[model samples]
Target: SCAVALEAVRDEAGLGRTVAQVRSERERLTAQLRGHGWRVLPSEANFILARSSRSVWLRDALAGLGIAVRDFPGNEHLADALRITCPANETDFARLTHAIDAALAPEAVLLDLDGVLADVSRSYRRAIVETAAAYGVEITAQDIARAKALGNANNDWILTQRLLAQRGIDRPLAEVTERFERIYQGTDDNPGLRMTETLIGDRAALERLRARTRLAIVTGRPRFDAQRFLEEQGIADCFEQVIALEDGPSKPDPAPVRCALERMGVSRAWMVGDTPDDMRSARAAGVVPVGIPAPNDTREEAERTLFASGAARVLRSLDELLEVLPS
Candidate 1:
C-alpha cells in the first residue's frame, strides 16, 4: 500500500513536496526508508515487519527500550524481526524514530501494504464514478451517497441504474453493465480523483517501519490491480510476497489469510484493518485481529460493533495496536 501511495505522490502531488497531501503518505516514507539504509518490503497492511542486522539483536534492543514491537511465535522466518505499525502524525514519527535509533541495527526490512501504504478510497471512488460514466449515465454526489448507504453490495449497480433512470433512459441491465465497463476503462485516470486525508499517513509510516522489518503485501484486492498499483508507485521491489484476492477467497473468509500465513511461514500473526470484516477474517483464519477504526466511524460504535462481532480487541489507531501487542 505504501508503494501505491508513493506512486500517487509522484503522480498526483509532484516531486519533492514534504507533508504528502494525499490520504496515504507512502512516497514520503519510502523516501525515508531508502535514506535510512533499510531494504524496504512491499506491503498491503498499514504496518510492516523489518528484520534488523543479525549483529544488532533488534528484538532484545526494543525490549530494552521499553517499546514492544509485534513478533509472532512459530513463524521462523519472522521470528527475528519486529512488526511496526505506521504512526499517523509527525509527533508519532518522532517517537518511532527515537525507538528505532535505540533498538535496531541498520539492515533489510519487510513491509505490509494495506493500511500502512495506500489510501484506496479516493482511487476506489474515482474508479466507481468512471465505471458509472461508461454506461452513459451521469452520477451525482447524492447518487454516490445513496450507494454508500447500501454498503459494498449496491455500490456499482444501484448507482448506475438510478442515474440512468434519472435521465429517462431505461436500458436493459446487460446494456447498462456493458456501458459501465466502457466508461470505467476510459475515465479511470481522471485527474480530479484523489484519496482523503486519512490515507496520507500510510506511506510515511511504511517508510519508517521499513527501517525495522521484512515486508509483504497480503490483501484481498485482486493480484492484477494490486501489482499495477505497486508498479505505478515504484516500490514493487520492496515486497517479497504480493498476495492478492485471487490468491484465495476474500476477507471474512479464511482462505486468503491462511494462504498468506502459509506462504510467509507465519503461524502466529496479527491482522490489522479498518472494518469489522478485517477482524472477522483474521479470527476466521485463527490469527490475531487488530481493529483500526475507520476515520468516519464513531469510536464507541466501532468498539461495540467489532467486539460484538468477535474481535479480540478494537484499537483507536494503528499506533495503539503496537502498544497492545507483545513485543
Candidate 2:
C-alpha cells in the first residue's frame, strides 16, 4: 500500500527531503509502471489500483489464486481492481509480485495511537493541575491521581466542583471551566507538559510496522491536541486516519472506535493501549484489545488489571508489539 510505504519514507526522511526529488521519483515510478503495460490510473496517492481489461476479474482472479486485496464495500471504481502496494524492499517487492501473480487478497491493518504511539499521561496530568490553578483553586496531587485513575471522565468536573464546595471555595462552574480552557491554550506555561512520551523502542517498532500496514490513530485525547503532538513528533503523516476523543464519544463507549474503523475503511482491527478503558472500548466496538502495560507498573498489578479487563495479549514493551503485528 502506498499509505504504508509513504509512512516508511516519512519515518526515514523526517520531512526533510526536497520536493523536487520526491516529485521526480514519483514521476519515474509512474513511467516504469506504464512501461510494464499496466494501465496506471491517476492517483493523488502513493499507490494505484489497476485492472486488466482482459477477461480476468481482478478480485476474483486474486482470490482464485489465494491472494487477498483491499476492497471497499461501496466504491464502484475500485470494485474491479487489485490495490497494489509499493513495497519498501526487494524481498517485499518479490513477495508482492508472487502474491499478485498468485492472486492473494490483502488484509486491512489498523493502528492505535495514544499509549500505543505516544506517552500522553504526563502532559495530561500537568494540564489538569495548571487548569485547576487557573481557576484560583489549588487541587492536591491526590485529586489529580484520583481523577486520572477514575478514567478521567467528564463527570470528574462535577466531583471537582463538589470538592471546591466542601472547601468553602465557591466559584461559578463556567468561570472554572474558562480557566481550564486558558491553561490548555497556554501550553507554553509548562514547556515540558506533554501527554505523549518518546519511547525509542516503540517508535522503532511502529516504523517497522508502518512498512506494511495501514495505520490509524484511535485515541481518547482531543483531535486538535493529538494532531499538534503528532506533528510535533514528526509522525502525523504515518497515520492514514486519526480518531480522537473530540471526534466522537469517550472510551468504554464504542463510538470513537467505530469512527476510527470507518475513517480507516477497515472492519477488523487491533486496539492497543495501557488502560482498561482502552480494552473496554475495543470490546464495545468488536475489535481485538491488546494491552501494553506501563513499565513502571508492578508486574502483578499490571497482569491482574489487564487480564481482568479482557486484554487478548499483554505486552511489556512496544518492541513486543512488532512480534504480534505483521512485518
Give lDDT tens digits, candidate 2, residues 120-148.
44544445566566556687655654443
Q: How does each model score on TM-score?
A: 0.48, 0.56
Q: Which parts of model 1 have CA positions greater than 4 angstroms off?
A: 1-116, 129-199, 202-204, 207-214, 234-238, 295-303
Off by over 4 Å in 2: 1-112, 133-174, 187-192, 195-202, 295-299
168, model 2: CA deviation in Å?
A: 7.7
Please give, for residues 109-158, the per-residue lDDT of candidate 1 as tens digits.
22224443555444444455665666565665445544443323222444
Candidate 1 structure, TM-score to reference: 0.48
Least lDDT summed over 10 consecutive residues: which range in candidate 1?
Answer: 103-112
Superposed by TM-score, candidate 1 places the C-alpha of residue 95 at a distance from the truth, in angstroms, of 36
